[model samples]
Target: MKVMTVFGTRPEAIKMAPVVKALEASPHIQAQTVVTGQHREMLDQVLTLFEIQPDHDLNIMKEGQTLSDITRSALQGLESALERFQPDLVLAQGDTTTAFVAGLAAFYAKIPVGHVEAGLRTNNIYEPFPEEMNRRMLSTLTNLHFPPTAESRENLLREGHRSEDIFITGNTVCDALQTMVANLPPGRPPELSHLPPNCRILLVETHRRENLGEPMQEICRALRRLVKDFTSVEIVFSVHKNPRVREVVFPALEGHERVTLLEPVDYPVLIRLMRE
Candidate 1:
């Protein structure tokens, strides 16, 4: 069976890498990758770390791109690729614009779509912005729903998805994380060299669209309080690339000696940093 796996963000790449590897290992399956390039450099970093070179790269990223731009570009790019590849089934993981549009394109082409990490819901569509809606929509079009947890499967069932179509596969992120951790070279990442000996590490990662403005500022303020109260703790935050996130984050968190606000690290580095 020929399967086209489409993904484009760091989170999606991390989760989908293990699934792609599993597919490649299967004697009966031919696995192919298509990257929408929705996240550009960060996406490429994960791909390189996982050694997943896409058969088709739709370089769709643009500065100041809107949701409509992403959806339109991904739909157009994926449609052409779907026509050319014509896989037996198309697979998309998580709830990015890439996943939603790729699945939609496959539906339009009368091809089956397999959704990985499916059935996640906040019940509030606007809470996570488009992600909650994206996954919910994809669920309607998906032939196979791979939900990573029992709760996720239940969510799909409650939504009237057929039980036979739902498969309770464990999260692939854990698989990826374990694989990387096992292969990690001895010693700490160079970035953490400045960390005081025996200090507790507090890794902070926040880039939710719902928390972008005031909520994000409040989080930064909370982090400030944490640093001030906990002298022995060091905070290493891998800042998001979005300027809006940075605008409030920098003002609240920057210039603090205990808070290390650095550029987002690659997947392995992130894992390593978290380990440290």
Candidate 2:
């Protein structure tokens, strides 16, 4: 069985890493990894942490690329890979544009798609922006659905998908977390070099389009209040790569004492930071 696992963002990579590893270890299955490069550096960090070498990297990320651009480019690139590999089934994780495109491309090619970590829904399509919409659409196109919990499986059942095709496989994030936690990298990352020993660390991250502008500024304001109220607590924010997010975040959080703004860290580093 030839199974090509497709993903793009860091979260998808983290959750899908264990699936890829399991596929690689199976003697009867041939696994191919295809990365869409939607996340660029952050995506690469997860791949390296999991020791995953992709069979093909689409390199689709570009400066200021919109969702439409990503959809068009990923669909075209994956089509080429499908034509070349002709795999028996395609596997996509989560609700990113890359996963949706992977399913759409596989559907167009008359190949079955196995959706890992499937059937997650917020009911409101616009809450998570395109992700919620993507999840709903991907379920319609999926053949095999691997929902993480009974709740998620119920979501699929409510949507009229066949029970035989749905399986409760649990989430891969737990597997990945266990692996990373067991073999945690030594010492504080250079990103946290300046932090004093044993002081409280308050982590922050805001990436959704809905939280931009005023909402983001409000979050920064609350962080400032936290810093002002708690002298012992230090703030460590992992800024998103998107320029629009940075524009709002950097202005509000920059130049504050004990508030350290940083680029995205490696998966293990992030885990370690959270642990401390």
Best by the lDDT measure: 2
Candidate 1, after superposition: displacement of residue 113 in Å? 1.0
Tell me each candidate's RMSD, in Å, in order.
1.1, 1.5
C-alpha positional error of residue 81 in candidate 2 after TM-score superposition, expressed in Å: 1.2
1-276: candidate 2 lDDT, tens digit per residue: 899999999999999999999999999998899999999999998999899999999999999899999999999999999998999999999999999999999999999999999999999999798999998899999999999999999999999999999999999999999998999778876777888887898988887889988888899999999999999999999998777789988988898999999887778878888877
Alpha carbon RMSD to native, model 1: 1.1
lDDT score of model 1? 0.91
CA lDDT, every model vs. true structure = 0.91, 0.93
Query: Can you write out model 1's per-residue Cα lDDT over 175-233, one digit (the tens) per residue?
Result: 99999999998788998998888999999989988889999989998888988998998
Among all windows of 10 consecutive residues in model 2, the one with the lowest summed lDDT is: 184-193
